[model samples]
Target chain A: MTHRSVFVVSGGTGITAEAIGNSMLSQFGDVAFTQHSLTYIRTEDDCRQAVARIQAAAEQDGTRPVVFSTLVNPTHRELLNQSGALVLDLFGTFLQPLEAELGVRSSQKVGYSHAVRDPSAYRVRIDAVHFALDNDDGGRTHHYDKADIILIGVSRSGKTPTSLYLALQFGLYAANYPLTEEDFDDLRLPEALQPYRDKLFALVIDPERLTVIRQERMAGSRYASLQQCEQETRTFAAIIGRYNVPSINVTERSIEEISTRILAQTGLQRRIR
Target chain B: MTHRSVFVVSGGTGITAEAIGNSMLSQFGDVAFTQHSLTYIRTEDDCRQAVARIQAAAEQDGTRPVVFSTLVNPTHRELLNQSGALVLDLFGTFLQPLEAELGVRSSQKVGYSHAVRDPSAYRVRIDAVHFALDNDDGGRTHHYDKADIILIGVSRSGKTPTSLYLALQFGLYAANYPLTEEDFDDLRLPEALQPYRDKLFALVIDPERLTVIRQERMAGSRYASLQQCEQETRTFAAIIGRYNVPSINVTERSIEEISTRILAQTGLQRRIR
Candidate 1:
């Protein structure tokens, strides 16, 4: 396997640069890489320092570093270009076209992208996180009317993470309910969730993976047993069929994939957008 | 503001495309855009379908749509290119150079990139979220030894969301403890937190913002009063001076910014990379 020096440099948190860089790198399955994420590289001086670090890393690794940058300032972009690394300028590539199409000049400000400019809008996202926490896992089922979506599944079937992800990423008030053994006995939607059936979304997982997942949480209990997992899987399917709830199997899906699928399947609006 | 139709198309969840698109478009602050996210566009057929949708929307909106995509398949890339919608091929622009440097052909497999290939590793992030929940708001201070970093802040001072973001984004075990009047009585770190001093990171917020945030949560209460917020801010500053703990003022910063700055200032490593 080949090794490479990788750097994700950005003016803001560097998250956008890293996301696209990782998505692209994920396609190349062979190479090994060690990533250095240098964020808050706002000024020309920061850019120069970033380039120096990238150059030193390239020299040490005996390979040119791949620098993924979202630096908006032209001066910073030019300074980093001098490093001669494989610079993937995430912003510079598309900003000019967007600017031309919009017939406006880009602001080119570093950091403070959305937070300070619209504090109230950002606060809604934070409030959604609190709402998810307050209503997680049948904890506050009475508040179902307020939720944008309600995820239902057996315990350890990914209801919690999905709820949290929906809240954090999309600013959606997502409440989840873990279908207990009693509900599986008759394969019926929980009485508490019946009132908000329109907002229901079911998640099912493979039995083998559920066993492994539950085993990690509780090693020897019946809950971790393969038999229990299979039963739960069957229960989820039966309930989905009976209730006709919009559903997806989340066995191998990332939170991003699952959340996106949910939004697409349910035609739910993301509050962030 | 000139209105335009924006499309984010991707082979995977489309998160990478949307993130980069949003980050770049944030620079062009004035133009109004209606974004349509098209995810799971994998095959040549899917690409053609995506283009049809984009072209239709562009025509309806009376302007060319801007497409941000991370499509990897060369055939799919060519098909989308023909859409003539000002496509920003996020992966195509950088993958060839990466392939040349790495000396390998790209896998180009869409979705299931990380989840199925490395389920155990992905499970670590979910486990981190559980850890954050289990230890949230001084619930399990005894588990501090397991934490990569412990955030200390006043209530509604961005501790909970920051902790959750740290756990979800970085896979770091982040437990947050809210400092109360009891702790601020003598401007001291809580006795429970003293043992974890090396892992301590303080978060301070502007009194005006805190008052407003608190007012939203508990309107007309003493806790939401500007006087109470001012006192808490002074208390936080005093405690930070006394304990000499590393900290940041998260008054106007996003969770991403605050979390990144926390990792940088504390030199705490993110477990994801």
Candidate 2:
């Protein structure tokens, strides 16, 4: 595999640059690349310093480094463009067109770049995150009425992480409940969840995967056994079928995929903007 | 006060499209935009359907909607190009240049678009999320030995959310410890956290903002009073000063900004790649 040095440069958090760079690089599974970030580069002096670093890196490696950037300042961008590297200045490529389409001059100031962000949306994230933590893993059933969606699954079925992702990323009030052995006694929906049956989103995972995950958590308990994993998932399916709750198998999906699927299936509008 | 409809269309999750669109649109602070996501769009048919939706939206609104997309297929890109909208197809803008730079034909496959993603990176995220939650809110100091960084702050000073974001987004093992009144009684670091002194990163917030956050949580209690907020923050400063630990004022910062600053200040490498 050919090795390359990749750098993400930006004026603010560099999240936008980092996100796009990583997303694009994932396509080249055969390439071996090391990534670095130059975040919070604000002044023209900062841009000059970053370009010097990039130039040094390119010379040291004897191969042009790949630089992904989102610099709003044209002067700063011109300096970076002249650097001895393959600079993909994303803002340089799209800003003029966006300015034309909107029929307004961009402030040209550095952006506080973030994913799904604004002051109001920031508030929503904090509130949702607190809600998710407070109501995590069936810790408190008293607050389900306020939850946008409730994730239910057997223990180690990717509930807690999904709940936090939905809350912290998209600003949704998400709560998760782990279905345990006690719930498998009758394979019936728990009484506390009956009132909010319509708000439930189930996560179904491969029994083998669940067993492996449990083993990592508790070494050699019955919970880590394949028999218990199968039993819990079987009971989980029965309960979901009995109630006809919307669900998806998360065997090979990432947390982002699971949350996006839930958003699509449940028709929940993400309050990100 | 112009109102614009913004649609993020992608062959995959549309997360990158949405992120770039939102980040750019935020620069035009005067215009109002309602954001929509067309996620998991994989087929030519999906592209045609999405263009129709965007065109119909333009017709209904009298002004053309802005469509940001990342379609991998040329045929699909051609169809979307004809849509009566400001079609800022991001992939079309950068792919050719990226392909030329790499000396390799780009795979042009529909991306698994995520902020930071891959199967191995996905495992890191899950383990880190679990670790963060397990050690949240000073719940279990037993696992301090494994934490990559420990976030210490007064209650409701943005510790937990930053810890969760660091884990979920950056694959860092972060644990948050909330400082309390009892810790302030003797004006010393807690015995539990004493051994991990060098690993601590303090969050110092404005007392007024801290009071407001506490008021929202407790409602009309001394814990939510500005006096107590001042006392706690003062004590927090004294502790960090005494230990010569690094810290940030998180009152005006978002979780992403806090995490990014932490990464920069602590020289911590994010394992997202």
Candidate 3:
């Protein structure tokens, strides 16, 4: 299977770019992909820098590559004009025409409106969207019959939210499984999951973020302790390494970017839209 | 505050339209409006019939005008061609422009994919989106100070999912308050919540659907029994009635339609987006 590079998403105000990018990522299956958002790009120089990165990804890969982007403005369009990759402009192509046809003025509320003050809600929805992408039965052999993807992660690493997002937004049957201490100590996946090891997507996150998340749920609780969170995170990472399983660190990116990268990396052809 | 006679969002996918409409619903304080979705209209005749109902709504008391159908297809648009109310064509406005800008063969995936199955995801997201509209701490009296809009209900009544959707999708700080048995007995809004009663959007559901959703999480458990579900639902309805709170029953309807209607009836305008 050939791996494509460069997925771009541009569109509505709130989470449109991230949402579309995440959808495209689920289609890719397990190779790593880099996502650079132009939301912070302040100058033409920054735009060119983004273009260079896309050009590099294209040169490194030899396939019908795709670069998905969602831009409300035309700046990113000019940047990608020379990138030699398939670009997806979500805003101008989809949102604008629909706005015109519907005769409604632009509301500018879709992607850019996320409230950072309440990162708890942001993280939850982000996790929901990503969790909904696993196409395999939630790490259980019997349930594989129902899964389009299986997501494995330690507690509060964002499986539920991501799973809901994928299943809800895309009609994908996504299931999630929590990795327990037993699974880590055993250092082996269940026999049922062994056959579909290649289909698993391990969501890795930094201990600090994990701790913060757990603390919100059970403040001052042992489960929310930083030490426990770090230990579990480390063990989970080692487990993935031991099995040669592919994983993604969700410490730095938003849910939309993370899901898109996973789909792109996985190279799983989405059989249904 | 000049309340629009009706706010009809008749475009985009059901999920997106609901999400936007839900957010917009929080803006009109105390003014009543009714929301309807055109998803059920399988024929042009159905579309015309739905429009007639909407016209009747617009002609009702101008303060509590009706918010009409979100026509998702061209046929619905034809039906609304002469409807004098405010028509919001979300799908048509968002989809075409996105597809054209992307230069893709189709924009179906990103613009308006249908919720063919397991629509719970979309409903949750849309509810969250709607709640986010009024999530604020300023000038919202004590008890009400913590929330802009508090979604109260028993388990599996779609509270958490909706709250997060409101926060993430529309930047609303929507917080959910679960209705415990104690609160049910009192059958009144928390005294703290009384000051903001005007801002409340009660989400009531049909006994059957409420049972179905709760059963999914606790299958075969006593909590999942239809009798138990029905009893709880009745109690919930009684509580709303005792308080004389306004609400809508979400049964045989998708979340998009229900949330849209909630917005219209509330006469709430979404925060600028």
lDDT of 2 by residue, B218-254 (tens): 8999999999999999998998898887999998888
lDDT of 3 by residue, A186-236 (tens): 778756677667667889999998887677668999899999998999999
For each candidate, what is the lDDT? 0.85, 0.85, 0.53
Docking quality class, candidate 1:
medium
TM-score of 2: 0.95
> Which candidate do you rate higher for lDDT, 2 or 3?
2
Q: What is the TM-score of chain A alone in each candidate?
A: 0.94, 0.94, 0.51
Q: How many backbone clashes can be found in candidate 1?
A: 0
Better of 2 and 3 by TM-score: 2
lDDT of 2: 0.85
Best by TM-score: 1
Off by over 4 Å in 3: A1-145, A180-182, A190-199, A207-234, A267-273, B1-161, B167-200, B205-238, B249-273
State the weakest 10-residue window (summed lDDT) of model 1 chain B: B109-118
DockQ for candidate 1: 0.57
Which one wins by TM-score: 1 or 3?
1
> Candidate 3 at A189: error in angstroms?
3.2
Give one digit per residue, the lDDT tens place, for model 2 in A1-273: 788899899877887787677767766777778788888888889988998888888888788999999888889899889998899888778888888888887887766544333556777888999899999999999999999999999988889999999998788999888888788788788888989998899999989988888887898999899998998898899989988989999988888788888998899987664
Residue B112 lDDT, candidate 2, scale 0-100: 58
